[model samples]
Target: MTEIWQQSPDGRPLVIDPEGGYHAAFLPRTADAPRPLAAFEPFVTACLAALPEHQREPGARLGLELFLLGAARRFRHAEPLADEELLAGLADLFERHGIARGRLLDLLGELPALERAQATRQVLDEGAATVEEWLASHNQNLTVRVRERLPDWARDLEA
Candidate 1:
């Protein structure tokens, strides 16, 4: 079957099959697309290069998610994102990996963080802590540690 290729608005590759079903395709960066973390491109490239060839696409996508999460938390004061926004970001990543949004939502609904985030929201609503404070407290765990270390690994790739 012949494949028709298009780029999603966020620059992910979309493949349209003869039957008109869409699939995600991991493709090389195009000139017109905005560079993600342009200042850290060298580091990102080196880190991706170190991954096994077959794993590169998924690894790169995960790295992007981590970078976004770290950046969002750092700049939360200037640009606050609701829980839905963070969840939407993960959904976008899953879509880029060829997972349907509905499936992604179903998967996320099963995660422990979903309940924790909701409970935290209730606490915040009760004025027990500000949104930022609640977020910072909850996000300080293993997942955030992993996300924060990703950039460090990327930087280390330059050594």
Candidate 2:
């Protein structure tokens, strides 16, 4: 059965199958317009690069879920979030997954520009600002600091 994921009114991520019943699962809502798989590649690569060698594979999977949750939240709002609000939501997500906020923030910083832009655009294309543009305009330097700390293993999605 094809399942459609969406955030419910209570802010829970839910899956609805073709029959229109909500399932007990947390699935990120798919974008209204499908994007290339490549749009997600950078997030996957960043997850892999951020995780320690012993937990790389599982970490990547969890990281993708966390990233998608953020995206879904953005899409639900149909607008850009204030930086503090975004970080707080992410912190809650990471806490639920037993990840430290600092570590998750570090990983987020490592995410490539292409992936960040794609995700931001996917949710806020109709808005005047892109994700990068918004960050730039606000002089948000946290993501930039993370970028500077990327390890050699971190791959660029654009490549």
Candidate 3:
């Protein structure tokens, strides 16, 4: 099947070649799309659901990276996002990613959305920690932790 997310907003074709390696343009989505971070929720949910049974490290890591990068894109936009709207969206985004998704939904149920990304980068910056960094220096114990969290497919990656 065609990649659902690869279709651009205006319907232009978008190509993402996993083999080509790191292409900046291939980020989660444009930094300015409407509800971009929130858009990641479903994909995150898929990852969380698939991880325990899927055993594909690359898929797991890619899922997290794509979802977070999508969130990061939303955050990176220069335009102002309402704090309440953004926070709500972020909570929704996280809930979508969280395995115990209900708690996040409940916690965010009454809160105003957060827009901390534009107020400062500190919060959004936290999301910038990359899989590469996580994998590179993790102590053997941490490595095991990372391995457990990752889909089995990602284990053989060379970086």
Candidate 4:
């Protein structure tokens, strides 16, 4: 949720967190604007590098890389790559980094949507098991279209 996109001078997406909430050290300045596909590894490396020595192990690095990738996917502006090209590029990136392809693919599967819905469910409370139930009981307190996605936003909860 903290992630946001900024457009580079060349019009490619630049993912950032303005509040310095997530991995603040690596925020790109104007001079460092990256080419689209080339941006992923360098950003991940910088964020991982910012962590203390005790936390710089391979597994931790892989997890952070995946989490950042998910956030970037959620916020990055539209680009022209075809689906196959994008996936292939990602797969190559993972291969180069020693991360498993299956892990990358699994991370890509509706993870961001599920994460948002899960957060909303927590905000609504444990007893609120469905979107309809949540809305019906509390609809008056909020604005319209705030959660118009309905069932999708509450997908993590039981019906």
Candidate 5:
């Protein structure tokens, strides 16, 4: 079924950037096709990369959902997101697109791992190590530990 999203159920719009301040038009639905959010994942993933940087803010969190709806509403548009950025991109996503905040957390199952990866990246960056070194060293030991704890498919290419 072809999808159509006027805006996220909550009502923020989609915005992104290499520099973080672009807005896409929100077109209303004129068709009856069910909006399959799952289909928008890849597009949301790509827009996640261009999302703006901001520290915690409760009022402005639906970024990911808005992007998902936008792209699902217009899928033929951009590139898919890379695996590494998906979760962090998503954390930011929740704020800007959430319909009921609770709705924002539909994928709560993914957060623990996402947090671990972000922490790993922070530790690696602080250590000033190369990506290769970060992978080789036990510097961000949490990421490794988390991978060890999860099922095989949960692991990344590094495994």
Candidate 6:
């Protein structure tokens, strides 16, 4: 169950471990391994592309995109990027997907970041003006479960 991943009938890799949870496998890396933000680009792109033209729940689709955005920023292991740079990157990503900066910020403002941060034990900044701020405040907790949820998100989009 642990040594090699078995292929399912649908050709998906499956493995079982004591935790009984899904996992994403990555090659082992040394302590100083470089994990650049670019590493998340393909997954983010594919996740977005998988979304149907007419979503049953547009809000959920937006949430999934937002999560992917935060994941892209959170996964980079080097020195933290500046807030301005991160904000610009976020804006660019959304804009590329046809979501305007103003619209995205409006959605961010509506999210209960403080409550979620408190619930998740992330750094609770009472006023997070943008998604980057919220994500930065919750980076640690956000990164911990990222890989596990990625395939789930893709499946959700396909569904």
Pick by lDDT: which candidate is best? 6
Query: In candidate 3, residue 91 scores what lDDT?
Result: 44
On TM-score, the stronger of 1 and 5 is 1
| Candidate 2 vs candidate 3, TM-score winner | 2
lDDT of 6 at 66: 56
lDDT per residue as tens, model 6, 50-128: 4554245553455455565445445432336665444445555555565565455444454455235332112112111
Give the CA lDDT, 0 to 100, for residue 118 in model 1.
41
lDDT of the candidates, in the order given: 0.40, 0.39, 0.39, 0.40, 0.33, 0.43
Write the residue-wise lDDT of candidate 2 on 46-110 in tens digits.
Answer: 43343454354443334333444444344335544554445454554444445654455444555
What C-alpha lDDT, on a 0 to 100 scale, does residue 22 get in candidate 1?
A: 44
Best by TM-score: 6
In model 5, the worst 10-residue window by lDDT is: 149-158
The RMSD (Cα, Å) of candidate 1 is 12.2
Off by over 4 Å in 2: 1-59, 62-73, 113-159
Segments in model 5 whose C-alpha atoms lie over 4 Å from true places: 1-40, 76-159
Work out the TM-score per prediction: 0.25, 0.31, 0.27, 0.37, 0.22, 0.43
**Model 6, C-alpha of 27: deviation from truth (Å):** 38
Q: Write the per-residue lDDT of candidate 1 for residues 1-159, one digit (tens) a residue.
A: 355454443444445557766443434345676433333223223323433432344433333333333333343443455654444443444455444654444333343353244432332232222223434553333333334444443443222
1-159: candidate 5 lDDT, tens digit per residue: 222233332343333335533333233333573333334343333334433332132211332333233233233223345422332333344444433323443424343464365432332232232222333552444334322322222222123
| Higher-ranked by TM-score: 2 or 4 | 4
TM-score computed on alpha carbons, candidate 2 = 0.31
Instruction: Write candidate 3's Cα lDDT for 1-159 as tens digits.
Output: 133243322243444456633212123433576664443444344434545544444445443443344334444353346654454455446544542223333223321232232322322232344322333443223333433545433432212
